[model samples]
Target: MNKDYFKLTGEKINIEDLSREIVSDSKDEEIKKELYDELVPKLRELHAKLFAEAKYGILVVLQAIDAAGKDEIIKYIFSNLTPQGLKNTSFGKPTEEEESHDYLWRINKGLPKRGEIAILNRSYYEDIISPKIYDTLDSLPDEIKNDPELWNKRYKQLNNFEEYLDENGFKVVKFYFHVSKDEQRKRLLERIEDSTKNHEFSFSDLEDRDNWDKYQKAFEEMLNNTSTEIAPWYVLPADNPWYSRKVATLALIDVIKKINPKFPEFSAEDKEKAEKIAEQLKNKEI
Candidate 1:
């Protein structure tokens, strides 16, 4: 199935192409209204099937730059997934306890059990992408102090982790929300200028913004290294929130569609037993 939201490695999609197809301008309010109307119900139906199947779990990892609408996309796509069948985790800097352990320890603890869908807001890619780009190497052991091959080794480790998950019946779908720097600047400014959104702004966000070029280079490298047949990364367009949500929802639904587990078929003996029970209840008053 051609599940790409926007092609990153090949000919990339234009902002206007995504905007026209995914979301019209806020001036055209009808697009958002219509898209959401169609979105929620269809997602709910997929959730019901995904929940009932009970054989496999889906791990959805969303990685995005600041103001790329990751939070908004999560809220919309998972609105209908039952709480029992779903779990959402947002990763941040390691706590003291988390810091004491290996990098994978915190992330492995967040994995979903069978028949559940776990949404990782930002995932272990931070271990590979963030530390390398930001020079957060103070925590690394002395053995790997300045090794040039450290990144390649980490990528191999990630591939092994994903391979293990796939063998154990977990489907990992990772998304990289690709927003242009200009678009990110616009959204950040919107938060800065509006009093209501001021609370969402952080000093660290600005620091990250300053290293925008470095982060993009890191992201490009990370995606190229980690994009495997077992666990593919979908580079999603994040310039339009409405369209992003729709695309995410559809991508998830498509994955769930592959696991087509119907309610079990009844045998002749089972049918006979049910018939006997039904005949006994026929005399009861409605």
Candidate 2:
């Protein structure tokens, strides 16, 4: 009911700042639970409207550090949306085939179709991170990789691709699940300690952990470069899984509300035809 809901207001919401509001300790369970209770219904209503007014499909991009609760956020925040109108896709380690193509090619294959909501778990940002961390591009000949001009060209290409999507009527909403390093280590250790959660851990995650600082720098640059009026990023505080889901829900619905798409209109002729059919039924003589 708040008219000002989801208005970014150019306010800088640091993850550390918002985490202070979350009742991480035992005393705040009631406050946390109440927020969840209130947030879910608002999300459900927004989803229903979005589903009906499905002219413009919404693409939600979720990016986060490992053990940042990306899966849990998806499971909780979108639990109420009908499967018929929603599509969820997760990108794993790139295949040999994917590695051979332009980075956006694989991601472009996952864009939402008309009249649907598409959620991308991790997106094209790997171009920035993968190259920076692995130095894979450095292996290329100096004719290509060594040129600052070539890298600038790729960044421009990425920006143009996103702009093209917007011009074609896709509503893009990107969220970065902002988890602190301390929380990340705690989560990874929990996976090690809990047999049930062990299945979620991958050996490759350690390799990623080795480059944690590099990835953080990668992410900051990616956010800075790709953050645009059309596809802005929301850096969600994800230390508390509950709060993460709540903020994701709030952020998504807020974007949907801003789009304010209306259902397709029927022509007057279509209404007249409907009325004639109703009149025949009333007469009951045919």
Candidate 3:
């Protein structure tokens, strides 16, 4: 895999300059599907190893604008993982109880346990972007609402939080699906035109459409501020869902490989006892 192709760890990224359409180097649809078919079983094997090792935890945070295929990607990539080892969470508007605590409180509650995988459909970064774009932070205390340094401060806090996770054996992998306005419009229209998909369209999504540029700026700044070595972001071209899923799968597999989880070895005495038990069972003896 070309490590530099989709990763945005230390690089400066401008959303305007990045193409939402698949790059020439991206595998075509058929090839992407074939690769994904081949990768899923390997991913499941790795996940099983990760579960048995009982050491490290993996957190996959996915962020995107409306109609960016976040759900589809999650479904496709995680379908083969052992259900007991995986948990999926999606964050929409915060509840009244959530608003009473610190922004990362709910996020902390959703973290994966050791040897498990947690997939967050949207995460604490929403506090940094959506509230800023929608002016939802105006109700907060003046220190946070009025301070020009608030975003920078939040970025520092986020980096510190991720560093803490890294030190404690949790790996954070973040992805920002970069869907073009034209593609977004197309998807939204599909939702409107198809009766079956009508349930997927939300009135608030229409309200967000008017703030498209504001949201883009917010996303760019968020990515620039928080894309770190420990919790790096991958900016995926989301126009072609197949290509994006393929890239995401490869990235995930690479990270799992780096973590290099393995099944725990038994002590010599335990191994001998297990062999004796196996022989007894094979002979249908007590």
Quick one: best TM-score, which candidate?
3
Best by lDDT, which number?
3
Pairs that collide in candidate 2 are none
Q: Residues 237-277, candidate 2, lDDT per residue (tens digit)?
A: 56666655666677777777787756556689998988888
Off by over 4 Å in 3: 23-28
Off by over 4 Å in 2: 1-36, 138-142, 149-151, 264-266, 272-286
In candidate 1, residue 165 scores what lDDT?
Answer: 92
lDDT of 3 by residue, 187-214 (tens): 9999999999999898788778889999
Ranking by TM-score: 3, 1, 2
Better of 1 and 3 by TM-score: 3
lDDT of 1 by residue, 50-109 (tens): 677677888989897788888877666685567788888999987888877788999986
Q: So what's the TM-score on candidate 2?
A: 0.82
lDDT of 2: 0.71
Question: What is candidate 3's TM-score against the reference?
Answer: 0.95
Pairs in steric clash, model 1? none
